[model samples]
Target: MTTYTLNVVIDNKQLLLLKENCYTLCIAKKVRDQLGDKYNVVWKGTADFTQNNQFKWAEQYEVFALKSFKIGALVEAASKKEPIGHKQECIFNDSGVMEHAKADPNLGDDTFKVTNQYGATSFGISTILNGEHNTSYISPVIIKGHVVFAPVNDIRVWFALKLPTGTMFSDFTGEYVELQFGGDKTTVTVCYDDLGSWKLKDSNPGVVG
Candidate 1:
């Protein structure tokens, strides 16, 4: 069977700085500079994505940054409460998913920064399919507590890789693709079934299995 893997890689240099002094604003700035401005590195603590799609618990001492992309317009529209007409629904089902998938071959590994109902910045993956977009699973790598207060000071990152359900191996142009995040790299193995439902596969920190 062909297997699909999704991997998350963290930048060690920046991670090291945070590990040295997670709470120090100066060190946080240095880390952010090294990681680039696009990432969501904050001096204040950040919230992790939850199953119920809520961000809770505000604590000091941990610092993190993330790079995320915006969801496609059609996918976004389908997700909202606004009424969708039959013609729009048909177009969405027939072409919406594939268009989004092809638009971003890196979709599996990239982070999508989404705002929840409460206006908190939550990290999660959005599905390309009509209803599935709302159900996409997101797992984030988080660093907790200050270096002084926390026993472990490690950087953990997680991203989701998804293919439209029933996508066959033959559907892709290549058997494998390599993805680079800063100085780190990861591989993803994908599997297919007749049901055509997207599958969520988790990978090791740097390796996908």
Candidate 2:
């Protein structure tokens, strides 16, 4: 079982700490409700290894659930003004596009093939979070490197990403994309735009949607 160390923060300062290693989604939600809308609850933990854990390499993953429109603002501010001159392939499902087309009649046919887009030149917010490197470091210090940002009340937008060649597991039942890196240990980074519309599996705790 995977557990997390939970912390409550307000104004960039930690207000409460729960380091019992027993924090889960249910416990976090209860704490969030009790804290109301003024605080931020964050957790740091490791994900359970897959049944086929053949490779014994260490990996790091981080999830950030920010307040309303915070993710957009951050992305916009961090995005490069000019392209980086190279594109990376990204695999995404057509569900989000189809949903948009359904909402707007002017979008035309909702039935269309989704193709991988290799047009991402800039790292955007990733540069700010991971520093000069575009990916996370391997076997980073837990307290300093691995961190989580839980939602404050109704905030739904989330940012979940992993380092290159690092596997990420999420229970987000929504439209998402993957950026895979193949090597001795294959791994991929999962991306989700909005969690409000996605349905999370209630059976599992700490599962993002």
Candidate 3:
């Protein structure tokens, strides 16, 4: 299991619902330092996929409990020889990611960033995410990590991976749901491949930048 370390800064705010447990977090293989820096990331499966088509997102049964949730483990990661990223709006409110990665070759990285939880800069404001889960295609995959939701936080934010129905859970999972970001929607799908690469798709109609 290739341990995948990611710095999730709520890549988008339109998916974060702290009180509602609705979030969409994503991770890429490479981060650019300039406009033309090459970048890439492996795509993999996760512990938060949709059931049939009813939105089986990875929600914590209890946020403040002792029970823990398990996501998939990372397999591998590398930098791709692709063009740098474009200027996109960052949004992270009702969004949030996991697990074994599968390589799908090295592709270009075209992603945006936003956070309503207040910017990390001294010149930014702390915003809040109020958008609904109307996304079309958005899924994140990482590797090997353990985290507890509720029963551990003393709040209703239960972790430990639970399907929307509170039936089954896994070390890592995947989800296929659309989010209502501002006024757009896309069929987001995240997962890991068998070749040890991570996969992420923001296939919304002009949704993801």
The parts of candidate 2 lying over 4 Å away from their true place are 1-35, 47-159, 162-197, 200-209
Mark the 10 consecutive residues where model 1 has the least summed lDDT.
25-34
Of 2 and 3, the candidate ranking higher by lDDT: 3
Scored by CA lDDT, what does every candidate get?
A: 0.21, 0.19, 0.21
**TM-score per candidate, in order?**
0.16, 0.15, 0.17
What tens digits encode model 3's per-residue C-alpha lDDT throughout 34-124?
2222112112212342211122222111011111212232222111111112222222222221111222223222332222222221001
lDDT string, candidate 1, 146-182, tens digits: 0111111111122222222211111112122222222
Model 3's alpha-carbon lDDT is 0.21
The candidate 2 region of ten consecutive residues with least summed lDDT is 25-34
Clashes of each: 14, 0, 105
* Best candidate (score: TM-score): 3
**C-alpha displacement of 5 in model 3, angstroms?**
22
Shift in Å, residue 176, candidate 1: 17
The global Cα lDDT (0 to 1) of model 1 is 0.21
Better of 1 and 2 by lDDT: 1
